[model samples]
Structure formats: C-alpha cells, structure tokens
Target: MRFATWAGGAGVVSDAGLHPLPSGVSVLDLVCSGLPAALEAGSSALAGPPVPLASVRLLAPLTPPTVRDYVAFEEHVEGVRKSIDGVGGVPPEWYRAPTFYFTNPYAVVGPFDDVPVPPGSERFDFELEVALVVGRDGTSLAPGDVDIFGYTIMNDWSARDLQAREMKVGLGPAKGKDSATTLGPWLVTADELEPYRDADGFLALDLRVSVNDTLVGQDLLSNMGWPFEELVAYASRGTWVRAGDVLGSGTCGNGGCLAELWGRGHDVPPLVPGDVVEMTVEGIGTIRNRVVSGVDLPPVQAARPRPRIRRRDV
Candidate 1:
C-alpha cells in the first residue's frame, strides 16, 4: 500500500490511490496520526476523480512534521572533504555512527517542479538519496522500534560555493542548502517493498541518475557503508522519532552530486535556465525537476529575511 499527498487545480488534498485520503489533509496527517486503516479501507471503495498528475503540483511527500538528513555515506564525506577544503579522507568520526541534523522541511518540493538555481550559485549539483518515512512514535526507542512507513527519492540539490562558505564557520550546512532540497513523486509503503529490505537489515537496490539523458552516476545499495537499520538506531538514540518525521540516507557513492565523485572543476557545465535532471532509485520511484533561472522578485525577497538557524530545545 503506497500513500501520497498532492495538489490539484482546486487545492491541496490527500490521496492514497486505492481510495482518496480524507479531504483537506496531507499524507503527513494520516501517517503521523497513525491512520493506516483509512488507507487500507480506501483501496477498494472509492471512484474518486482521477487527480491528473499534470494538473497537480507535488509538495514534499512527507510534510515531515520534522526532518533530519544524515551524512551516512563515507564516499560523500570524502567527496565533501575534497570539494570544500581539498582534503581527501573521511574523518575518524565518519565510522563512529550515523550523525545528522534537522533541515527546513518547509523548503521541500516534489518531482518535476522547477528548482531555481540560487542567487550567485555557479556550482549547482544533484545528490541522489533515498529517504525514509517514519511511522512509529516513541521516546528514544531501541533499534527494534522503527516501523518505517515508506520510501521516496530525494535530490539534495547543492551549491558547492555556498556550502564551502558555511562549513568554515563551524555551523553546519545552512543557507547553502536551504533552497536546493527536493523530494517526491510518490511514497512506496513498507509492505510494498518487503523484498528489498532483506533480513540482513540492508536495503539493496540500484540507484542511478542522469542529466540530459547522459548517465552521470550509478551505484548499488549494497555498497552503503552504513545500512538503514544502523542509521535508524543511531538517529533515534536520546531522541524520539515520531510519525511523519523523515530520515534521509545521504548520497551514495557514485551518486549524482559532483562533490561525491567529481572534484570542483569546470570539467562539466553548470546548471543553467533549462536543464532537466532525472534520478531513480530501485523500488523507490524517480524524481525529475527542471532547473529554471529564478526571476528577481524583489517584493517576495524583501518580505522574507535571509535564512538562519533556529536551535531546537532538545
């Protein structure tokens, strides 16, 4: 049973495919609220209007009541090392356990949406990641407590220039990453992917990405330095993971983002006003977003302050 939240010409709505989700709500509302029954029952009883995929806009699949993206890939860590400071090895802490931080869930968007190249961003890159949707709720549950509702594809679109600037300040990747995050298309439920999540507690799948029909990156899921179970276990320590929260499994080695495999050089052209980036992960669906040169809307810019960090009470 897969679940999704979407928008239509009329307005935003909930939809589970078999049956429409309750009106005026989102997938986050249903999953976090623990109402899988509504999804189960809807599978066979509704002739709801077919929400045209084209007419509707896709918001981030998980409203995430909260969001956490982890840096679990050692290759990406090494890659980030070289991209930002010309360093070339993973830090000793890279193998300790999965470490992560909250990102702005409000910045998420769905597949096929137009991603604006941020102001002065000359080194925009794409990161192919698989993100999990949390379905269980508990205060610091053990490794056994995670009941993931589903998975989706995420493009941690990045601006190498800004990222390099922020990391030097001791604070994590902030404004550099604020506007480039993208996710969506659909959320494939756990039940629907039992075969991929094997007994060994590893998710094995083929992940790939391409730009303009040229395959720029590809990798197998078995290569992950840390599997999903390890990530969930470490991430849940000393903190509660609730329904609707999201856990992103960072970018895999050989994945799209240039910082992961290619170094910071002009060997490749940067994203301009009209480029389409399509990424696919086995089991999880593909996400395609077009890059558009954003219009300089001064009013909208003035109304919003520059992005900044807000520490949580935890």
Candidate 2:
C-alpha cells in the first residue's frame, strides 16, 4: 500500500482514491508500528469513503525522527570529488563501508512545497535520490535483519557555495544542507518494490529529475555501491535506528545533482527562484517543488581565537 499524509490526515492511496486512516493515527504512528500493523490499519481504513487524490494538498509523508543520508554512489562521489579537489577518484575509506551524515530532520518539506534559496547562498542545487523509512527499532543489525517500512523520493537540496566553504573547516555540510530536504508524494510499502528487485537483490527502479520541464538527469537505483539494507546496517552499527527514521541512498550516478554534472564539465545554471524541480522514482512516485527566495540573513561575525591552554597532568 502507498501511505500518505495530506491536509486531511494520514491515509492509504488506492485507485479508488485516498482513504483516510482513523483520526489521530498518523503516518509516523504507522511507521513505528511496523509493516504487519500498517497493513492491518490500511486494510481496515479502506472501508471509509475515498477522497480524490488531486483535491488534497500532500505533505511530507512523515516528520522523521532523524535523517541519515549516505554517499553510496561511486560515480557521484568521484564526480563531486573531481570538481572539488580537481581529481577524480573515490576515497579508500568510502569503499570500506557506507558512509553517511546526519541532516536536520526539521528541515524536511513536502513533495510540492516551496524550497527557499538558503540565506547567503547563490549556488543552490537539487540532488536526485531515494530514501527508505525504518519500521522498527534496531541496533547493530545485519543486512538481512533490517526492517524497512517503505520508500519515497528524496531531494537533498543543497547550497553548493556554502557547503564548499564550510567543509574547508573540515566539518560540515551543516548550514548548507540544513536549509531543506524534500520527501514524499507518499511512501510505498517495501513489499510493493519486491517485483523491481534485481537478481543481486538491489532495487532496479528508474530515477529521473527535471528542472523547469527540462530533463536534467537519470539513473538506475541499483547503481549504488551498497544496497539499502547495508546502508541501514551501517547506520545501526552502535546507535539505534528507530522507526520513523529515514535513510537516504545518497545521490544517483551520471547526473544526480548539478555538482556531479559540473564535476563532469557540464555547465548547468544553479537553481533560482521560480524554477520547479520534479523527481520521479518509477515504482514509488513523483515529487515536485518550486524554488523561492529566502529571508535575508544578517552577516555573521568572525569567531574570536581562544587563548592557548597550558597542558596539565591529569
């Protein structure tokens, strides 16, 4: 079942239309309850009258408890590294394991929401990717043990100029990335994607993105260095990956983002106000968002140098 959260409330999507779940039960609640329970809830809720899908305003499927985005695509990593470092190659550490960084959960936006150009940013960009929602709490899980609730389209919006400057300090994509993240249209249950899994067990869904009606990039979901299960397993290494948490499959190869294309010598213009970004993952669905101007920010003052501390014996 495709689950969604909209102006009306949480509901199940069907050919008939959107069937509202009982009042007070949210998509988050369903995610935390795991697949069996969500299936039961969706089945029971279908008896209610359905609402036209187009009439309702869709929202981000759920407010994730935490969002961990990985760099699982070698092509994207190599291309981005070449652009930033003037060399094309993947780091050795990257091959050892799936690496990820935590992005702000609160920065999430709905499928069709307006994303503002982050304050002090000029090189705004969109990343085409796929994300999975965790269905149960788990830690140190093996790949086969990962419990995923569903999948959705994710746009990891970026401010390239800001990200470039911050990472120089050796520590962030922080403010550059925290500006916004788009997830939704609706979340398709994991079972719905089984038919699309390849012989190696990787999802073979087709991913495409367009900027203002111009096709910018396309890739296969199976291009990742590791599968979603492995990404989740790495994420659960020592910390708990609770239900409602989201794990992104990073950017796809070939042209997942402007940066990747730019690294490959493609001269694409950065995103600007009024530019609409539409991304689609074959089985899951599509999400469209428009860029808008952000609130002007006051200039930040440079930090003062701290006095050197004398070493003392413990």
Best candidate according to TM-score: 2
In terms of lDDT, which candidate is strongest? 2
Each candidate's number of clashing pairs is 0, 0
lDDT of 1 by residue, 1-314 (tens): 55555663112223432335556656776576564653553453344655655555666665667778888777778766787778878889878778787777887887778999877677787888888888778666666766777778888877778788778889878767777678777777776667876557678888898888788788776567777656677777787778877888888776457776555352666667788899988876778888998646343233467567788668
Angstrom error at residue 160, model 1: 0.9
lDDT of 2 by residue, 1-314 (tens): 99999986989999999999999999999998879999999999898999998898999999899999999999999888776557788889999999899999999999999999999999999999999999889999999999999999999999998898888899978988999999998999999999999999899999999999999999999999999999899999998999999999999987889999888899899999999999999999999999999999897788989968789769
lDDT of each: 0.72, 0.93
Clashes of 2: 0
TM-score of 2: 0.96
Steric clash pairs (candidate 2): none
